[model samples]
Target: MTDKETYQRFIDWFRRTWWDLPESVHLHPMIETYLTPEEVDLLTNIPHSSQGIEEIARTKGMAPETLEPRLRALANRGMIYESSREGSVRYRLNDSFFAMLRAALWPGRTDEATKNSAPHINRYFLDGWMDQYAEVHLKGLRALPIDRTIEDKREIMPHEDVVHVVDDKKYFCVTTCPCRHRHNLDPDMPDCPHPTEVCLHFDELAHYIVNNGLGREITREETRDILKKAADSGLVHGVSNWKDGVDTICNCCSCCCMWFESFHKLGHSASMDASNYRIQVRPETCKACALCVKRCPVDALQLRVSPQARNKFGKAAVLDPDRCIGCGVCSHKCPSQSLRLVPKDQAELTEPPRDPREYMKHYLADRKAAAAKNQNTAD
Candidate 1:
């Protein structure tokens, strides 16, 4: 196919894929701004290898200045990356984007109906299954342990800083995974657009262990022991301890954490799902102690009791499962040990419900209603 035809096809595919994402998550303006027809053609038709801007511009019959901004913009948005060699820059699409494109264009791919049905299946059956699946399938993956012996901990290291040790055998660190950092492209800055790619130093295994908390079968003490070893090995910074069924490890630095960054940008409501479970507090066993209230990361716990009836321990803690992420942070702090993470089948992970079509309907209706209300007010 011609370069222009190839580019058009890719853009159509991207738009269709983008529509699948909720309206709440929109692409950066820079991405939209630089996705010109010519640029699109270049990106789609360009071979699966890096090409210098001058060569690309010359071949495409575009000026360097005209092409440079578009190239930089694409690079910044994590859609592409630039490599410097001999004072010239070569641009290539990020691996994640390329992979997605390939999958979208692959012959005999599943129909759109199957793709649309996936979320429903995931929400109902695959929610809890993913954790187990990831564990079983990925447990053998290698990762470098942060070198605790290194005195200078201040330097920002890539994911490769650690060396993987399995069965007392050391292995060379490798970057073989695609993370969110590789796919997110911010449009605001053209020259240094994409977020820093530190995939090489990211400790995915550490994150998985922390999130999964050793296992559901293990005791808190056993989990704590594992965390302590991880900390000692320099894999985790700060307090590396286990509480309840959750492992609480101090993850320092802002850029390294997806959860922290999501929490910062979108608030706790946006960051976590109300676990497919709810925490229950036994009032009789609960000494009106408010320990659980303080430990809740999302402020899902609150103290409630009449002032006259309040004992020396003050008000009892109550859990609002709607805001809980099932991290189980609250269970550790209860002095009376009244709080327990109990499974609640009724609770869902997503808000306004999980049906994408219904969600879109409601979202669109809400927007229309709000606009009408605004117009009425103006009148």
Candidate 2:
């Protein structure tokens, strides 16, 4: 009824979607800062599923031309998704994770509202909101090993190989890393030194992003170049936790990545599931440069005394297998080539769900079970 109630209702609507806000972040400042009473009111009329302008206009009880501009404005603001296929245009509300966070900032918008929301979004993630994602045993993302870091090429699956993942797509694009972009926007936050424009999208997702001006279309070779630059910067390759139809590959740094920061700063139990591979160390050949130790995002590697080590310090990188995510950032930069990712013991390996269909089935089941558990505890 009131403006406050209208905004709260919009927040409530997002809760029913794939990503629910944690209880502590019910009215997140970042959400409040960008959204307005008028925007919230208009968004309520938009459907979750895509529909044509005429169809939406009928629902609004207005002329199609009258309603089109409003819908286009929301789409431009990243509050809605728009697509054009075969001369027809359609629109739908973007999911909260994208609308409020990823897509909202990925375009590197310099507008006042976007800049103001940055610090609040960064604070929300760091404070407690990220724990909701970690509560589910099924992670949304999995580490993809860097190229040339696998110990045995024969063991690499198409999904596990970054090059194959890129090759599988017909379209490619690059966008600013929302995580790093957020931190870089906030003057109070520590400056993130890693490359920011390395978030890669492919296929239909790439089409949507580029069409919406969220990112720029790039050649596959350019995409690979971005991947190479990310690896050189000690960034981990993170992709959707699925075996097929993976749409995104985020070049994540421990300092600003949502998943990595959730694990490293918020003390979440886990950020992402490890790849099927784990680092294999050759202590005898280890130069003990400690690059791997420094590069490991998960604190998985440490330099310790090793009689077998050939380096001056008599210390070599030792892995806490439990902590390694098999991301290969460490191995990619190994000067002595003493570290490489090898297939985990078959019994310990985890293959991601076959595709988005299977992945969401498992994800929804986990969410439902977690909700039930929390309700029972409350009772």
- The candidate scoring highest on lDDT is 2
Off by over 4 Å in 1: 1-270, 284-289, 306-311, 345-379
Candidate 1 residues 1-379, lDDT tens each? 7644654465554444212212211222212333455556656533346788777788668898887777666553334556666877676544422323211111112334223322332232222211211212111111122333232334412221222111122111211112222122212212222222111111332332222221123333433444344333222222111111111223222232323233443332233223333467766676776666655545678878744333565566776766665444556445666766554454342222323344445544654665587799999
Candidate maximizing TM-score: 2
- lDDT for each candidate structure: 0.38, 0.86
Among all windows of 10 consecutive residues in model 2, the one with the lowest summed lDDT is 20-29
Candidate no. 2 TM-score: 0.94
RMSD of 2: 1.8
Worst 10 residues of 1 by lDDT: 132-141
